[model samples]
Target: MILTAFLTAAVLVASGGTATAAAPGTVAASDREVQFVSDGVPAYGTLHVPAHRAGARVPAALLIPGSGPTNRDGDEPPTVTPGTLKLLANALDQDGVATLRFDKYGTGRTGLGGLDPAALDLPTFTRQAVAAEQTLAKQPEVDRDEVSIVGHSEGGLQAMLVARRVRVKSLVLLAPQDLRLLDLLKIQLDAQVTAADQTALSKVITDFRAGRELDYTGMSTQLATFLQQAIFSPVNTRFVRSDDAVYPPSVARPGPRVLLTCGTQDTQVPCWTTSPLAAALRTLPRPLPVDHFQHAPGTRVNDQVLDPSVVTALRTFLEHR
Candidate 1:
């Protein structure tokens, strides 16, 4: 779902400002929409500090939304359904863990404060984690030492990037592919194309891999537009246009306990099948957390599922671990 659809209101005004609480599908009270500055750009997020929040420092986590222009809530515009991330924040809040989720650059209320959207790039987006961490740590209700991040899809990789710079109590990467963006795009494209178009699309992958333009004749407009989003976007061009897959080495394995997950039916990032990233992760200095919920059937198993299971995993990791 990295392909775009990123939508959401700029949820979260500054602290002590008007506390516009959005209707919680599962809870009630001050889930404040907060804002912070990341590299001179104003960023917005919803800080889910539970109404029942007690103690001087409860464990909290920053939830990083997935690929594309995904908003703070786990979905994009025009049709914001039951949000995957709003559900996640609700789950964590229920477990008494505070959570924060934000809109990336160029999306939501981020660039409206005068920063040119065209100037935003991959680092502009990724470095927001550091800013988010700084902002979240300052909250009186959060235990900064126990703080962690849960990154879904590309955000999972973004979590890895942030981990490279800071130490967290733990990290959770949901449905992340270790393959570079260009390579992963190829896999996604191959899945959606007809057999007859395979050769040409393969050529597209090759050309793209080599830094060549996707100059083709008679290719479907859908494919061309997908190329623009999947490859040529300003942010994507800056970071994801590489052959270097940023998982194995970028992540300091022995540093923090990490949880890696993949949905059985998640075709977008089929890390469950392609590349077998676990094999690489297993040989690291620290063993990745044992893959939870590894059931197949009779247990409400899924050849198909959604991010609700992800909510359970997040709650388990942040609350129990």
Candidate 2:
């Protein structure tokens, strides 16, 4: 049941028209561009260092990109104002913490390896993030033992997997989905299509849950197949079913702290998705501190820029601990 829903969501994203904004080449004086080879391909990133960290090693964060082709600066095709990770990096830098934000496997200035997005799996995603972390840890200005991961959206899942395998000091998850991939996908599709006034979402979800192909009106055939491959693929099923708590609190070496954040107005990854994950973590025998922050949406808002409050919260969390 979960597998079906997961596949459907993957399909929706593949066929969805969420655009990426163009990358802007602006940076503060303390920040510099860096590149490293991941899986033999060069990946681009920006390293933001604090001005006061002239000789002292500073706490560092590896900013993980969310789903899709978002660039190192968090700018996507459709719009450009928010500059997601880029904004976070600047804020952290100002607060005396160093940060590294990079493009995903095939996005921005990074090279694409001829891999189809429909065929990409969680393991592949995890590897990219781990490589990024490894790259950042080797930097002279970054305190290797004090480094942490700040993963947003799908990146949160990847960060968890990496932390379990590597020695890291902490983790920060933003609007992470704790449910099985399939279930999360189903909910997302239902909400998105319903908001769009598309009646086909209901039929598609029903058919998908029954382990059947979804033949809905108004869905293009190309999109239909793409969705099928993305959602129902064996790769995605294995990811959602795997035991992810290998680094349980009872035995987590070099035990890392954790912080989770969600926006009340975020329909994409609502607060409900994070609550269960937080609850489950609390039940662990050697649980680390889990902090939660909720941002209330404003009526008149700035869409093209990062929320100042969110950045401030992140700065405080990453720098203090």
Candidate 3:
């Protein structure tokens, strides 16, 4: 768990007031502040629609952010301000695609809605994604039939789940994780700890699976803190359990066209690791159309700036879809 597309048309929606117009000579997308209620939480986001010939309904995408308290712009501020989603939204706008990017419960203006963050579960976020998709599809300016889900990192996992629940034009997975959640965590943690500490990490996972409280005894402060924040904490327990239960390869089902992208420099979700997902998709009962886009050298998943190759590849994928 780490955390983060386009078209043109009449850009109005019932969830918000009129869409804002782009200034003269600027290739800015028409932006509108939009809202949707998910599980009684009023989620806030921005709808970006590219300027196109009047009366033309363009293809659209629902931008789902990655893990953690990432905002609608795919940033965890004060330190992490990648703005990955925002830049992708702008890129999609240039490609004549509309997008809806929203702040999840714990981030930005959403602010957890008086709910306890410790009690948050994966279903809460899944419901939000589904609701956002519904909202985007219902927009008068979006071609619902041509709508897609462009998910990055953990969002790619969420996108797979969303695709099973709702029909979409395609699935765009950016540096998505292909391994089971806990397994991936083990790999990440192993890289940081000594062989002895790795044993402790394994025990921690075992204790978690056994429904016992994680024992951080004898662990390094750094590893313990990371476990507390990202894994063993009550705040993420429910979500972690739910996420771990999901095997990514199992969800690569037939239905939507799939575009899986990976950056060679992404140490988190390596390009080679995506093979399981691709192989699963290939083995589906029905043949599924899938495209793989490998980024140029030096493109890492955590790039503060969007990689141009990714933008171009994504635009081409959506354009052909």
Candidate 4:
């Protein structure tokens, strides 16, 4: 189900701590618990301000997590513990940049928030991120005009959506899916099947995307099951249609400074696949230079410890602006 969910639609979607400390190096940062109501759901998150810069306004970012049920920390838990977003927040905090990361409708303390999980869709998630962005900008310690959005994997797509409706100084996409959801899935499924099977899978995807009734004949058991659970299920129908309607390249506008990164070892969104995105960004309104980092080695589907070089690149990119 996890793999099917990722292949079908992709999942997209900080606080402060500390008052006064005796020693300067004793504290990292404070996790200021924050909240915002989105679509009538009270979302929860943390605001992280560096220990040294707790009282001063600082350039900040709203961190959006990837995939399903991921929390503010960027961990899906028990089964996945990359801690990607939390590590990012820590790095940004240490660099004196405040961050806000939250749990979406289905995850963490914000679970469902009394809404039916089946009714969740991308627009609501975008609303949540937008609200978080506004909340971050309003922070006393955050420089509103200097705010940015950093989204990983599916969250990168969400970042683009949020930026369309809000103001952000920059966008950092980490291992984001570069192709449209179905296109990426076609390539992914093609890799595991024969030519005939690929053709059949393509037909199935085409029919589904066109809103035609699906004929699952000739599909492998795995593909049929995946289609049923990930794409055909009523719980996923609305979300898949909404997400598929978006093509990231078309949404890549010329406003904000953009930085895109893809990991060499990341099977989901490989470096080569992001060339289209990189190209789109290069042709932006003013055609400014886009900082593309696609050579981080040893980065996996999830990194328990984020690559130091990647972390450095992110800091340099955000700080450069």
Candidate 5:
């Protein structure tokens, strides 16, 4: 479920300090360290703002990370090599857009984010996102009403959740998933199981639904461990029950602007599964304004976030009228 743009991290300072925001042609640190409390847990974030220009305030976005141990930059390495989000933040700053990217539970300085990993739940992430959004909105450099939520992978799904609950300016979903939590898991796991082990895996899913013990008698130790920790873990059941989280129709209405990006080669949350997020926006009850771009030339992604195409496309999308 580590489904973000399979991306990477930030260039935040070790403690609260300021950095020079880069000129478009330059690559500067571009951010300030900020703090927000989620569910009473202290969460730290990197706030990327345009260089203070004549006391101007720019639109802000909350950059949310995907699942597992993804850092503020969208990376959970060994599985990814900093593809999408971190670069996107820098690109946005150059465009005069401010952004806030937070470290999720069990990651970076937030390390546990004041929540025990063993007792974590999906709400923890949602709370963190919302809290971070609220925190960003309070910044004097931000236009509160224009604060948007940009989520990659699972972060995209989380963005949908935030949109429905909060009155935000827009949404940006990067390789956002369309399937229900458990169903997506089933498909992904099925790909790994052999025809010989199909029955056993099927039984495991059945048992999980029925709240029975998982019997991994003949399964490889690695696979079994994966199933136990990632799939059947008690910490994630609430999400499994959310029924595909939010779908396209749900996101179609009541938002300022929505940009959905798809990387043609994204295998984890294949951009094709959801019938193009743009379609949902186009067919909305109110026919909302939408912008989307899929790398038609089939860009090869390093994880889900590192593609240069993602940064370029996003900069264009944000700059579009």
Candidate 6:
């Protein structure tokens, strides 16, 4: 079963490292290998179904990855091999909820012929997400009307766009940013620079805004390009303006049940940034329930750190609703 496999993996990971395994009661009941096709590209994922709900169709969640090359398990560059989503999926499975977590386009086992991160725009990602949703809806054990999406970070933006085009039942956003793409990137860069030199950081921001590439004598071309894209790309600017420009009143179609979460320590997308997003959603003149969950005892600016409690909250939300 999926839960059993996760327990086995947890035991192995815990025994081999300083990390603690999930408490016995927190493990899932079962899991299985599942795959789907998106735009002729084969996408792979794992479907964790609660053991108690065997033979019964259940509410389902599509787990969308954050930015970069994060795979189905939420692992990305500089942090390879961590199965964050897998662990979350297992925990949710224990609660009689099924989760489908897949790799972003051109990542993991998905075909890469037409995939290029640098060339990708918001709509491209949204289309892929919608395809993934439809694929999940067609599964025999998934209740189409009860299917929702749980997107983390940038994927949260993608989830919102996807919802506009699909009939998702609910949405859960984790540490989502409400700022325009360029502004968010500038904030992130400033934070990183402050760790070293405030003066240099300010200069770098000025240079970026002025369209001058920063000096990267010691940095690789890849890192340089990434920084450039983060700061100057029209893609990010457009995404931000488009999202902000949405007329909330026009989106009044019985909105999906929404849950927005952020960590107190999340530096990449700080609580302050996430608060505005939740506030904006609350302003929508619709009759939908919107909830916010800010992690207690929040850490300082390390959004990459995985908190098991977040997973618990997600499971509770999906199961009870």
Steric clashes per prediction = 7, 13, 7, 13, 10, 5
**Once model 1 is optimally superposed onto the true structure by TM-score, how far is the C-alpha of residue 150 displaced, in angstroms?**
0.6
Shift of residue 237 alpha carbon in model 2, Å: 11
lDDT value for candidate 4? 0.72
Candidate models: Cα lDDT each:
0.61, 0.58, 0.74, 0.72, 0.63, 0.58
Off by over 4 Å in 5: 1-15, 21-30, 77-83, 217-222, 234-254, 276-305
Candidates 1 and 6, the one with greater TM-score = 1
Give the poorly placed runs of model 2, Cα more than 4 Å off.
1-29, 114-118, 192-212, 217-254, 283-302
Query: Per-candidate TM vs. native?
Result: 0.76, 0.70, 0.85, 0.85, 0.78, 0.68
Q: How close to the true structure is residue 276 of candidate 1, measured as C-alpha lDDT?
A: 49
Clashing pairs in 6: 2-30, 2-31, 265-299, 265-301, 267-301
Answer with 2 or 4, whichever has the higher lDDT.
Answer: 4
lDDT of 2 by residue, 31-73 (tens): 5666666434566667776654235677888887665566787
Across 105-188, the per-residue lDDT of candidate 6 in tens digits comes to 556755354544345555555666776677777767778888988887676776777788889888877665456555675577
Rank ordering of all candidates by lDDT, starting from the highest = 3, 4, 5, 1, 2, 6
| CA error at residue 147 for candidate 5, angstroms | 1.3
Q: Comparing candidate 2 with candidate 5, which one achieves the higher lDDT?
A: 5
Per-residue CA lDDT of candidate 5, range 209-243, in tens?
Answer: 67787798777777788877776667655555443
The candidate with the higher TM-score, 3 or 5, is 3
Best by lDDT: 3
Better of 1 and 2 by lDDT: 1
| Model 6 worst lDDT window (10 residues) | 1-10
True-vs-predicted CA distance for residue 184, candidate 5, Å:
1.4
> Comparing candidate 4 with candidate 6, which one achieves the higher TM-score?
4
Ranking by TM-score: 3, 4, 5, 1, 2, 6
